[model samples]
Target: MIIITKNAKKYFNYLLNKKKIGTQIYLFINNPGTQFAECGISYYNNKQFSNDNIRIKYDNLFIYINKNHIIYFKNSKIDVIKNELELQLILKVPNAKKKIIKKNKILKNKIINVLNNIINPQLKQHNGYVFLIDITTNKDIILEFKGNCNGCSMSNITLKEIIEKKIKKLFPEINNVLDFRYYKKK
Candidate 1:
């Protein structure tokens, strides 16, 4: 949900009159949940509304939000600020760059537990270990290597052969198991 300031709502109405079609506004986020996330506002047309979007009636205008991008827009605010004779549309989106909660936490933790119980024991033999760093939305696993395995060239073989194979066996839904890269120890 987003809050439209009094001035912002007026500004939106101003834009609606200029549009040739529907009196609707669209809020969008590009590459959300990462460093490069960008939030934007645009004029929306009635013809574009579908199951992919959720609509909310705000005063005189309707707003549409993409169902997949709602997480980043939650609790956001839109305001029109005048500075140095210039009017700027400011978007205050907290969850855009900072995510509130991960998508699939239960599966992530389960993968970690599986790795900790089955994989770490063998890795500990080499004074090395692999732990889950993140689970991407695509179900690919991100892992970090520690101890002797951190800089070992054989780590790639361990990842693709042992780790990836075992995880794919347990969770057939998983796509890739990637190793997180960190600087070598001094």
Candidate 2:
């Protein structure tokens, strides 16, 4: 899970509220998959949220990460960097290229175990169960809803508050826990 420093959070909230709808902050590698890679931040409002991006919300701030960028960003933190010339928000991905955990098997299995043991049991009472579809290239978990869970009015609530929170707690290495049905390519 990404951490926004308190100072950065305050500043980001101010900037985010001022932007028009659809605005999102992006953290990316200037030169990916290399020793020369450096992480940077920028803001734009264009494409709507889709399967290709991992949407992260910290309070009112919305950050969008391209699915391919997840491994590079897993352990990163966002902070405000201020100097005499300029002040800005930055993504700090230490050991950027050297530590990409691609398609982590152990973490994926842990997620499945949690779902079966804790989550599905609760959902089973409601005649619902969730299935792990796949771990995306970015390492985000993609889940497919089944039984009562599929097309349930409260599915979003379950995905965000319960399912997502549980997965993030168990595997911080994952970027975003996304429902497969939510993707609408644009």
Candidate 3:
């Protein structure tokens, strides 16, 4: 069953209308995972090693799910929640009681502070700044490159070979690093 939030009706209707004849919108609950959606974009969710929340927004419509409730759905259920929230069907599968690791916010903050104080200052000459975007329990770090580094050809190399290497030396727990940068036209 799929649940559609009250605000999602118009958007859902628009999607349905856009579909050709019998073509159906594939809606599935991402148990043991999460989905991220951006404004004016199609909705997507994936179930992977971590059970993340589902998020989406269209016009005034929004949809979200709590991480804790992901385990209960054995199958997919799509319906509207209280005629207000639009939700999708929850997919049922064998419960994989994998250990859920909460993110280490304290460490994340420390890392961010270090980047601001140490990393950014070092890159100041290049009109670049290193920003900490997110940290996951899998010891993965997400960073954003801004200013001159945004469109630089060597940004990826700098992120992996320079920034990430230094960070790993300081925080051994960080096993993976990702660059999440978007260029802003000046």
Ten-residue segment with the worst summed lDDT in candidate 2?
A: 95-104
Give the per-residue Cα lDDT of candidate 2 at 86. 71
Clashing pairs in 2: none
TM-score of each: 0.54, 0.49, 0.44
**Per-residue lDDT of candidate 2, residues 57-176 (tens digit):** 788777877877777776688889898997687777865677455546666777889999999999999999998888877877889889989999999999999999988887877888
The clash numbers for all candidates, in the given order, read 0, 0, 31
For model 3, residues 42-98, the per-residue Cα lDDT tens digits are 343232222455444444444444445444333433333333565543233333333
| Model 1, span 44-162: residue lDDT tens | 78786789999878888788989878878889999999999877889899999875565477788789899899999999999999988888778888899999999899999999999
Best by TM-score: 1
Supply the global lDDT for candidate 2. 0.80
**TM-score: the better of candidates 1 and 2:** 1
Query: Per-model C-alpha lDDT, please?
Result: 0.87, 0.80, 0.59
User: Which stretches in model 3 have alpha-carbon errors above 4 Å?
Assistant: 1-103, 181-186
The pairs that clash in candidate 1 are: none
Q: Ranking by TM-score, best first?
A: 1, 2, 3
